[model samples]
Target: MEFRYLGNSGLKISEIIYGNWLTHGSQVENDTATECVHAALDAGITTFDTADAYANTVAEQVLGDALKNQRRASLEIFTKVYWPTGPKGHNDVGLSRKHILESIDGSLQRLGTDYVDLYQAHRYDHETPLEETMQAFADVVRSGKALYIGVSEWTADQLRAGHALAKELNVQLISNQPQYSMLWRVIEKQVVPTSGELGISQIVWSPVAQGVLTGKYRPGQQAPEGSRAADTKGGADAIRGFLRDEVLTAVQGLQPIADELGITMAQLAVAWVLQNQNVSGAIVGASRPEQVRSNAAAAGIRLSGDIMGRIDEAVGDVAQTDPALTASPARRPA
Candidate 1:
């Protein structure tokens, strides 16, 4: 597998990071999850990303059990905080010092590891002071619970503020995890430039637009059976926005491009995201082992400028490029 340094940091992660967002401990059985993790490792994927809020905090335990036999030093494990993981309480969420401090211990315990290679803020906590958040992250690093810090789905302005404080606190803020895909260009306009300038690389999620880019959901028809859009517990709600006729038709137009490249629509989609120089990795989630192997093949493929242009022409109109779309949710769940 191809590897890249996460931002300007010395830590190297696989270009295709195997992530368990909706599958682990929820959608897939434990044995199935273990098989997928093995498939990823067999395909040379060393980076794994999960979150404390995923599957109500059970995903980490599943991933930890799956990787228990592997050599810990060879893997780049990443997890996130923020979002309510336990019982609903006012202080159970946000990036406050109490939450950050308490969350790390729970995350470490669940992951079966003393430390995570990178710890991220799942979202910008509008209710918490930025200083307190960064300082808490600094404490996480100093305590050796996390080696580096990252943030997910944060706006460029929020990233800049947190990055500045990270510098003051002498902690490394090396990566940003955002929902970036051929169809979702929300991060390209502002977040990408800001992160590039601040030495932060993007580990993009949903590179296939939650399977919409795979051409499995045809226009003028119901979603295929057992697909993400059809799976209520998986991504039905998240995939709805991209299910419009104009968007699906545009996505269908990319079949010729994928055929010409001799790659699956999903591979084409993942490779399209990695073409950006600022993207360090593209996170792919899977319920089946073969899916992991197929996505991993896209790791080192380089798309020519001509192919990229063709892609842009295909989905440019339907793509969500508005910078305002990068804003964090107004009301986070407690």
Candidate 2:
């Protein structure tokens, strides 16, 4: 696998970051999760991204157990805060000083690590003052609980303000984690440019559009059993919008492109995101070990300008490009 510098920092992360969002503690068994993690390591993925909110905090414990034997220095671990975790208590959410400080300790304990390579805000907390949030992050970095800081799904304006405050407090805001893929281009218009100027890189998730870009879901047909859209817990909800006939047809139109490149649809999807110079990494999750290996093959693959144009023409306007579509919750969960 290939590696790239994360933002302007000295840190380098695997281009394909192994992430556990919906599978680890909720959809798949612990043994299965362990196998996937091992597969990622075997595939040369040194970066792992998770969140405290995933599976109500069980995901971190599962990932910790999976990587308990690896040399800690060999990995780049990332986790996030700002979502309601642990029984969803009144004080358990947002980026307030109390929440930020306490969440780091809890995450460290759960992940079985004293410090994480990166800590992130899961979303923009509209209810909390930005100053309070950035200062808390600064303390997190100063105390050595985390090496660098980042935010996910934040607007461009929000990133500018947060980056300015991070500079004032003397901390590094090096990355932005956003939902970016061939089907999701909302970040390209504004966030990409702003982050570029501020010396930040994007670690994009859902590079396969939650499996929609894998050419598994077809137009006017029942979703194949066991697909993400067929999942009932929360997967269906996450991928429902992309299951529209127009979107499915548009996605299927890329089959010829994938065939011509001698790559799978999933690889094409992941490589497509990495083609953007500002993207530092593309996050991929898996239920099976082979899936990890397959997605990892896209790490160093480069698409020419002509292929990119053809892909755009194939997907047409069905892809979501409206900048407004990239958004975070208006308020922290109660």
Q: Top TM-score: which candidate number?
A: 2
Candidate 1 lDDT over 1-334, as tens digits, reads 9999998899999999999999999889999999999999999999999999999899999999999989999999999998897895888888899999999999999999999999999999888888989999999999999999999999999989989999999999999999999899989899999999999999999999999999999889998887889888957987899999999999998999999989999999999999999999999999899999999999899999999999999996899999898867676575
Local error of candidate 1 at 333, Å? 1.6
Model 2: pairs clashing at backbone N, Cα or C within 3 Å: none
Model 2 segments more than 4 A misplaced: none
Which candidate leads in lDDT?
Answer: 2
Give Cα-based local distance difference scores for all models.
Answer: 0.94, 0.95
RMSD of each: 0.9, 0.6
**Cα lDDT tens digits for candidate 2, 1-334:** 9999999899999999999999999888999999999999999999999999999999999999999989999999999999999978888999999999999999999999999999999999999999999999999999999999999998999999999999999899999999998888999999999999999999999999999999999899999999888888788999988889999999989999999999999999999999999999999999999999999999899999999999999999988889998788887777
Off by over 4 Å in 1: none
Candidate 1, residue 102: lDDT: 96
Clashes of each: 0, 0
TM-score of 1: 0.99
